[model samples]
Target: MTTIEELLPDDLLETLRGRAAGYDEDNRFFTEDLEDLKAARYLTMLVPEEFGGHGLTLRQASQAQRRLAQAAPATALGINMHHVIMGMAYTLWRRGDHRLDWVFEDAVKGEIFAFGISEAGNDAVLFDSVSTATPSGDGGYTISGTKIFTSLSPVWTRLVVHARHEDQLVFGFLDRDADGIEIINDWDTLGMRASQSCTTKLHEVVMRPERVGTHTPLGPNPDPLVWGIFGAFELLLAAVYTGIGERAVNLAVEIVGKRRSHVKNAPYAHDPDIRWQIASAGILMDGVVLQLEKLTGDVDLVGTGEEPQYGGKWFLHFSGVKGRATEAAKEAVELAVRTTGGSQYFRRSELQRLYRDVVAGLYHPSDNESLHASYAKALLGPVRE
Candidate 1:
């Protein structure tokens, strides 16, 4: 079996790491990194072998993402949106639904897919949409709405989007050159700047009948499409943050080994307080690894003809792991910065860059507020009216 290390070799990672600072500093899209990844066929990792891809499972793909993130987080994150779309299609196909087979086919042909689901005020996410999808008199739909945080916008050939169609929610793909679609290049942010996840506005864009994927009832249910999206999205997202934590811990260890304490006349690694902080960061990272392994392994078991039971706790499982991973990653990064002292505060320091990038975790879906509310509802049932 080909490993992630072989695919994303040390040389490639080093090259990416070398350019990370420049991308972040200039707030530019990771154009060079994207080209490198494309040459390596990283985008089609989840597509099956028969489709001319590596045919890696979600577990393997998540591991690959973690390694890529350790090199350049923004690069990994920008590409992650494409993998998430591929993973969702793979999830559906694994369960004998071939409606999304075209995703794999297009991916093999090098068509990049961008996620266009987020809206300004729509917190319902995946369950409801503020965008409207009106019938276009020929079984297709004319979608009109704005989608925010559209990663891979600079290069995506196809965009997967969803909109409200009366009582049902419609999912479809829009070509980049399609009429009435506009990509706003306003991706300036505090961190993850290289992702270039800008805002996309749809002015009654037409989605052909063949491009329409799935339709589900409003307000969440047991739709396989929903499960596919949540499953691939949450786990893959957690992997990126986990990689950030791992990088922070590794950097801290390296710094401690080389820097000596003036007060103690010895390396900071010998100091009990520094050691404790590093150890705490490692422990938090370990918990995230354990959670990722269990969840991703269980998800991959479907390929072996064995379905792991979640007992109606699937949402909690997915969202909860994401919440834990992101929080743990943020805390771990903090501890690392503390151990490294004042040097990490400088803009030139990689640790400082990691610090800024990790802050974006608090903003992703399954946020603290939603996670807490979901946990409460899961444990005690929905609240009284």
Candidate 2:
């Protein structure tokens, strides 16, 4: 029998590698590529073996996310909106529907899932979301509210809704086709242009009590102090940041190395100021990779449901990885621009799109302001990670 891993050849993903860096210009759309990924069974890397999946480890999952990011941040962002959850949903669903044998198998076959967290009011962590779930007449609950920037909404069959039900935090799984739910095509984002992070709405949708399954086990729901916490998830973001930085630097170097040297009374790539920026970006990318490996290794060790020593520091580590990687990635892209000269900014060039898209990672959740507060909380020493 062919394994799920065997089904998703690196070549297929690699074929798309340049696309991530080339996204907006290429007119790429998940609705267009997603079927092919599903046909190849590329999304099942995380489903547990019992669920008939390749069940790749956290390291493997992180590496896959990086590869996809390298191809197209939007592709990775949309696909990984499901990819990150693939492996773990097995564990999560195991606690609920054992029949996920079919779903898990299908996921490896490229079915996807996405998070419905960012809404009209809650684009970032600090903002409050408008979505809510309330106790319906029966054991089940009704979910209603609008969410914006909900990526992969078009392709995903399920959405993991993080909601507040009567002042209590809970999550729920909602079907895209449910009677009361509607997905609106209105992301209109400046960067990550093809990600399709649109608006979604649910109007008093109902779910069977059992389907509630421990809280919206729809996508990547982090269960505090439990299996939901891991650097694999956070570091995946780091890997994307690193991948963007790496490509931006490489493309810049390629452009600079070929430029006229000493033709304009200047060394071009050899100029000290330009050289300094390239060198800085190189070091910054290296730092991203190092931090990624360290956090991945650490998280894999204690991903168990049990409490561990690193637990207290995990949140701080998240802040640092998210904070630093965002800065480093953006800096590298900026350097790529400085080194490539004005021609690189031509509206049609790949560099332009790469520069624009890479910037989106910087503003993703855990922006610098939130990262600082997270670090501050960590330093206080009395609270948890």
Candidate 3:
């Protein structure tokens, strides 16, 4: 029973942890991590068995992702975009939809995939796109616009982007070497620096029509693509933060058990208040982990045609999970810092980096405001627009 937890060997995980600090310090992409993951065939974890992949279910992948995050938060976060995209394709394929089979094909062929649909000021999310994709008069379209937060920008071989084409929102794939695609090296950020989530600029980039996977009217509809993206992204994002929280709890416990006091102490682990704080953080994290297990497990139900009974309810659930997990990560990190004393405040400390990285979970989609609104809608019916 080689479970997802064993996907990354202890030695590999240690190397990742050792390099994490240097990568963050230099604001560099996790190139070595990516290479190791590729060698392990992790990039194709979700691809079908016929495609020479592990064919792990979404649940297993989510578990593996959490474990990966424990070793390198930024690396896991960056790789998550790719995994979520693959998860989306898998979800569709499992339900007899072959529209995205090409994505899986590409994945099995060692081509890196990056999700580039997010845009600045287009909070409408999957419903709208600020970028434009006009007919190129050759059964293709010319996409022109800028996409921000394009993770894996420095290494991805292919990028998937969405843009408005007339009254429809269309999503297509672009090659990294595409003639008019430019990756702006402007991803210097306060946290998750190793992600290299740079801005991507499209200048009349031509994409073949076959590459256009989904096209829908510019608004909500009974489209599984939308649901898959929302589901996979939120769930996996939650998993990453949950991993960060787990690490924080472990670190807190280790520090409290090791730090000694000259006055009257064997170690602070025996101190009532220190134990209380660590216990509290552990309890919070326990709730998050249980929620993750449930959500990821139910994702299979979504792929098995049981989605209609739940309908839009899963979105609300996922929002709650993402919000709760991120906040719990922050809380756990804060408690870890407090228990570890002032030594964690220094830049060289791993706790210092975890503190910075955990806060970034706040910026992802289904943010606090949106999460509240969605929860309200789910509980109290739709509010007046």
Candidate 4:
């Protein structure tokens, strides 16, 4: 069967670009744009075959994300949270009751599945999620705690919250309207404004055991190759940042061609210094993209199941790629700003949003300091410099 990536027609790509182009003017894209992704079945790429999904490999899925980001970074970010959350469902596929054909079919049919894993008072790492679930008379349990930065939560129908039970870290699907849950005010962030990564409160919510996945612990993901919990998150954020850089470079190329340099008596594109800076950024993204592509291939080959550190080298690859990509995208966009000057920063300008979006990646989970420490730990075998 043809994969969902193959099904993404050229028209959809162009429409995404148009939507992204609009973001600079007025951050118009929001959770609703995720509906576009659902309609396109972009969110169902990882559902297993028995669930009637395309079951794409990671590399193919990464390329799909790359293409979507290339069109509109804002829309890409919004839709992708749902996409990634659904994709991660594959990791939980083997643990739960696979017979719940609706979760699979509805997901493939474009249902928006948002993941909630980060908690405000917790360790801030994947394994550090401190939300808890306790036994109830029913086969399910009572889940209570506050989850923060639930990307795409503002509009999702169902949210998957991860919490620790006695021995197993469980995954529970909570309806947005479910009792005991409240979406606090909107997320006011320096970047990714359209992502809707808001804080959510869950007061003693009831959940069924059938709706939760068992054995996935509350702390560090048991996987070795992907750093278990943090790898996928880092990889996606890096790819997104890198994609924004790609857009900036392309914009710079288009702008320089038509605009004349006020000082040099020629187009700025002809200036040696500007040309070199642009080329340098382009080259860095080129290298980053190659690494991202390779990493995707590695992930596909490695699969999602837990293994060992040496067996998978998970922490090492994710940290390096994520750190490199975020930095590369940020530096490139900054340089593009230099290449374009004051004109690109205006409200009417395209580069304005590109610049904001690209820099946002810098603070994501794989930022320089956090990533460096992770890699250092991998090398020195503990959390060390």
Off by over 4 Å in 3: 303-308, 381-385
lDDT scores of the candidates, listed in order:
0.92, 0.65, 0.87, 0.69
Q: How close is candidate 3 to the true structure, as a TM-score?
A: 0.96
Candidate 2 accuracy as lDDT:
0.65
The runs of at least 3 residues in candidate 2 whose Cα sits more than 4 Å from the true structure, single-residue gaps closed, are: 1-14, 17-28, 87-106, 123-129, 215-233, 262-267, 303-308, 381-385
Reference-based TM-score of each model:
0.98, 0.83, 0.96, 0.86
**Candidate 2, residue 231: lDDT:** 42
- Tens-place lDDT per residue, model 3, 78-107, is 999999889888878877888988888888
CA RMSD of all predictions: 1.0, 4.5, 1.7, 3.6
Question: Global CA lDDT of candidate 4, please?
Answer: 0.69
Better of 3 and 4 by lDDT: 3
Model 1: how far residue 141 lies from native, Å: 0.4
Per-residue C-alpha lDDT of model 2 across residues 47-74, encoded as one tens digit per residue? 7767666656555666666656666677
Using TM-score as the yardstick, the better of models 1 and 2 is 1
Q: Name the lDDT value of residue 206 in candidate 4.
A: 76
lDDT of 2 at 328: 91
Clashes of each: 0, 9, 0, 4
* Ranked candidates, highest TM-score first: 1, 3, 4, 2
Put down candidate 4 lDDT per residue, 1-385, tens digits, no spaces.
5554565777877766666544444544354456666676667776666677777765676667767777777666766666565545543443342434456676765566676777765644555457778878677877888887777765777777777777666666776666898888767665677776778888888776677544465445654311423555666666677788887888888888778987788998898888999998899889999999887666655433542334435666777888898888888888888888788877667677777777767656655776676667666777435
Q: How displaced is residue 118 in candidate 1, in Å?
A: 0.5
